[model samples]
Target: MTDPDRPVAIPAVPRPKDRPGRAPAPETTSTYRLGQGPLRLPLWLRAVILACCLVEGLLLAAPLLGLGSARAVSLMLGGFWSPLLGGGTGLYPGQGAVMFLTYGLLHAGLLHLAMNMISLAAVGRELTRMIGAGRMALIYLASQIGAGAVFALMQPQAGPMVGASGAVFGLAAALVGHAAITLRRRRRSMAPLVRAVALILGLNVALTLLMPSIAWEAHLGGALTGLALGLIFAILPRRA
Candidate 1:
């Protein structure tokens, strides 16, 4: 017979989900690796930014190569003109719509080109990561068109307008909308996003007032469109 004073021992349960020496898996998120910064732009984002830069370079170099004034030709062909779109100029139909997209490729000068490329780089990387390249394309194109329409209506006599400021401003506005959605998800206060939006808008206003040549209407239009689309993205479920 066994000894009555003998003690029984309990066995330890093994955790299949975790191992003794292994680290936990990293969290999955729709958010991009923003900590990596702009240098980590994906393929599509890099393509778009590089295309703009190349186009601007070509426009600048065209004149020197005796290509018959690329800037003048670009302004005449692609620049958004209210009169031309409205049939006042009796040009081609739907020309204004074509120019809406093309005008973004044109720049007033080196400074204008540089500013737009920088802005695109800053915003495009994060946005492309968050929304994917395809959605980003939609937002950008929609912003360009919306801004063009607004500029056409607001400044019918403001002369030909050419630049990517509208699209750039739209990207900024979209970030604000994205920030709002992010704050909601984290159950955090939205005061920071609100402040940022206010600052951006205020800066736009100041620039518009100080610089007579700036097309504030286009910026406003693009921003509104971007905000709308961004909110829509935020509300929808994540997709592949």
Candidate 2:
């Protein structure tokens, strides 16, 4: 009561950690700490993933819905066929052109879709972060078209090519290209890049030897396209 003439003392509040046997309260801020929250994917990336899943889901549910086997129907309607490029008749007109983009959305099976989507998510997330979604999307589209063209050119009699392997490969190649450029800027050895390229080629060769059905031509085409674009992007000055 008499402290008003001198100084007033206030007891300090006890922190959660200061309390005996009491643990600290969990953080409730809007920001999340490192490696603690759910991964937030880009909108476009999520949309792409959802679209692929939806297509696959619909295909799986086709028979249950009394639509009969839809795999063949979907492939015929959307799969990339080499003959179509050479003026072959399609179930619908303009399908030949549309197949260039649509083929990437179709997959042979769940395993195939899973592999492609995983790769897309991993590499795509990094690339999208480096270059905005628009450019990443552009790379993906260009890669798909390039892949289809190369597949058609190389395997003129090959069966319908489905899956996003080519686009994923393209994204990987772009990542490698960017890495190569960054290393070159630092005067580092290109051995790592060379090894990475060789490793990809070796993997493709191994997969082709084992499966014999892999569309390696498309992979090659996508890698080439992505590498070319990546190099161009790396060399160019960044925008302000």
Best by lDDT: 2
lDDT of 2 at 231: 82
Alpha carbon deviation, residue 151, candidate 2 (Å): 0.5
Strongest candidate by TM-score = 2
Per-residue lDDT of 215 in model 1:
88
Reference-based lDDT, residue 240, model 2: 65
Report residue 220 deviation for candidate 1 (angstroms).
Answer: 0.4
| 1-240: candidate 1 lDDT, tens digit per residue | 644455434344443575678995554434233234344766765776777788788888897899967778778887888787566652566775688877888788888888888988888877876777677778888998999888888887665888888988887778788778978999999988789888887988887888779888999889999989888887887775
Clash list (residue pairs), candidate 1: none
Name the Cα RMSD for model 1: 11.9
Cα lDDT tens digits, model 2, 1-240, are 343345344545444554667776654424223344445667877888889999999998898999876989888888999998787888888988999989989998898899889889988878876666777787888888999989999988775899889988988898888888989999999998899889888988998899888899999989888888888888877676
Runs off by more than 4 Å, candidate 1: 1-39, 89-93
Residue 218: error of model 1 in Å?
A: 0.4
